[model samples]
Target: MENMLVTRFGHAAVLVETEDARVLLDPGVFSVDEVFELERLDAIVVTHQHPDHLDRSRADALLARNRGALLLADPQTVEQLGAPWRAHRDGDRATFGSTTIAAVGELHAEIAPQLPRVSNVGVLVRSETGPTIFHPGDSYATVPADVDVLALPLSAPWAKVSETIAFAQQVAPAIAFPIHDRTISDAAYDIYWNHVANFGGVADLRRLGQTEATQV
Candidate 1:
């Protein structure tokens, strides 16, 4: 894959552009303003209904701008979002332009036994001209094989360093990068980064700066 680009917009939001298509993932509240400014998107995928991942307040406007883009979300989120949003469940597949998206995983990681679980579907994206990438939204419940790049969630209420490292080992991608990292402070970022670099079992771990586009 040549000229493939992945641009992070803080936390879990990212823009993936290949030679044939452009896709946006998890445009949550923490995502930067530039996300809304984007046009000509092939698809806008939401992992779940969480405000941090869906950004209900601004979603309508974003969709209005990219009227041609497919709005896909988890089953429960589809019910909540209604028209214009379709369900993307485990084993389901969809195509936008030359990019193919396959849904995997089912539920969000257990935050606690008391809190109810919600649907969360991770997506695997493949393009004829780009590397295969996987983004496991809020869960490590399912591990897909033959991934070229992994969007590893670096921090969250339900995530731990051990599980994060183990998840990376299980997927065993050629390269990995951090996401879901709004909670990390400047002082503590290196601690997490170093641990993953030393033990995550991936050959390369690239830390993306906010809004910076990097080739993976």
Candidate 2:
């Protein structure tokens, strides 16, 4: 099998490339401007409707650039975004070139009891010639089997260090890396990464620099 290459465009946005496919995950507001310049994507996946995870302002242009890419989003996002985006609910699977994407989980993590809950889905992406990676959008509820690389969420209003450690331990991925971290400062990142490194229980924990690609 060929290796899979993953590039982080900041926060939760990632460009995952395999031998036969190139897929972008969560091209959100926090993502770098370079995300819009990417081309030849086999698919664009949005885990939820949150602007931080799906930038509505740049969505049109990005779609225009990758006109052949499949657009997949959570149920509510599909309802909100309308045409061209298909709802990828829990248990639903889609194939893009040689890559297979499976949607898992349903609701975003609770921010507060007063806030309305929105739909969310964690995606599991695998290719016949590459590693299996899991990107858990905003929730740590679904723990898929046989995950090689985990795109772990490092910070959020709805996340805690303890919970982050627990989630990584539960998934037990061979390798893990941080995502959803644009909100915190560099000092805070050091603190959080320290804790996860000590207790996340994964064999390897990688810190991906913005816009840099790493092969697995």
Candidate 3:
């Protein structure tokens, strides 16, 4: 994201600076200590209604602080936010500042009997670098199958190594990483390593994290 002047702010939150302005994604509430330090924002793109991924407090903070942020979200999320948000559906396309964004659909988890109502969406961020990064919300990791940088789930409820491998194999990104694993055990990381190293045609996994950004 060097050319796009992007930076990671922990969990799924990220800030992208195009030629015109900055855009925030997810902006998890925890990100307040780190990312919310920024004084201004051009817009916000929300993935779903999950608290960790879409904290109302954070948006409210942005509104109170920046006040100029334009919000984009899936329909259900749009309604839930209660703040005026431009709705974005799967396959819908739009641009934020100079950054081009595509909203895509994703499964919340490997099908569950009781939690079908929760909705999720993935984001394909197109930089002048062009489709360099993709965030698969808090999803099952099969969202964007062939982007430059694919961010998949490594440790969340129902997210096993098998599912991650399947997604890596399918997405086949040049470099891939995982998210939603804040409280997971070390075993999950081991699985992620083995799969990316051995799985044929899987993405060349890099495993970027929330720590001060470092290239793996």
Candidate 4:
């Protein structure tokens, strides 16, 4: 079994590569040109329908390039693609060979539901990677009690330092990685230590910046 290699492409975009194939999530900021190194993806898993999460035009272009590849996403994302795609709901699992990915429903933007917005979801990817990783897309809180590696969304529109810290304290993952952060801030760094850091306890809290990669 090979470790699941994740290459953060800034924003919510990430390229998760396994030995069998590569899968991308929420790649919106840069053009496909920037991801020249990411080649021949087997699937592209999307979390929601937000522009920042999915570039409609870029996704259509890439979908054409890898037309045969699986484009598994929420209903809105699949509807936007206007192509043959797999729409995943909560508890739905996609198994490719020995790999497995589970879709868990989530709240969108932590805002009022009456705002007439679409749905959101979190992804629990469990392969032969270092651990079962959870990328909570843009969600600031979740119900799952256990997490191995948490790719937490920080510095979002509605997320405060207090909410993020409280979330981490509740889940208490084995390791926590800061994500969805537009820019690194000292204040945000302080929030992690003052709140999420389990140095005195057990969890290994890690912060993966725009360019860093954790060796699995």
- Which tens-of-lDDT digit does each residue in 1-216 have in candidate 2? 338999999899998888877889999999999998888998999999998998899878899999999999999999988889999999999986777999999999999999998999999999887789999999988899989999999999988899999999999998888899899898677998989999999988889877878888
In candidate 3, how many Å is residue 47 off? 0.6
Each model's lDDT comes to 0.89, 0.91, 0.67, 0.68
Q: In candidate 3, what are the lDDT values of residues 19-98, reduced to their tens digit?
A: 66577788775454666656678778888877777777656656677667777887888786666787777898777555
Error of 3 at 196 (Å): 3.4
Candidate 1 lDDT, 75-138, residue by residue in tens: 9999987988999999999876677889999999999989999999998989866789999999
Using lDDT as the yardstick, the better of models 2 and 3 is 2
- lDDT tens per residue, model 4, 1-216: 237676667767767666666777776653234443455878778888877777776666677667667778887767766657778788888877656678887557655655655767778777754456777777754557556667777667667767777777666677667677764476656655555554313267666656556643
What TM-score would every model get versus the actual structure? 0.97, 0.97, 0.82, 0.82
Error of 2 at 164 (Å): 0.1
Q: Which ranges in model 4 have alpha carbons more than 4 Å from their true place? A: 30-33, 112-114, 128-130, 183-195, 198-202
- Global local distance difference test of model 3: 0.67
lDDT of 3 at 47: 86
Which residue pairs does candidate 2 place in steric collision? none
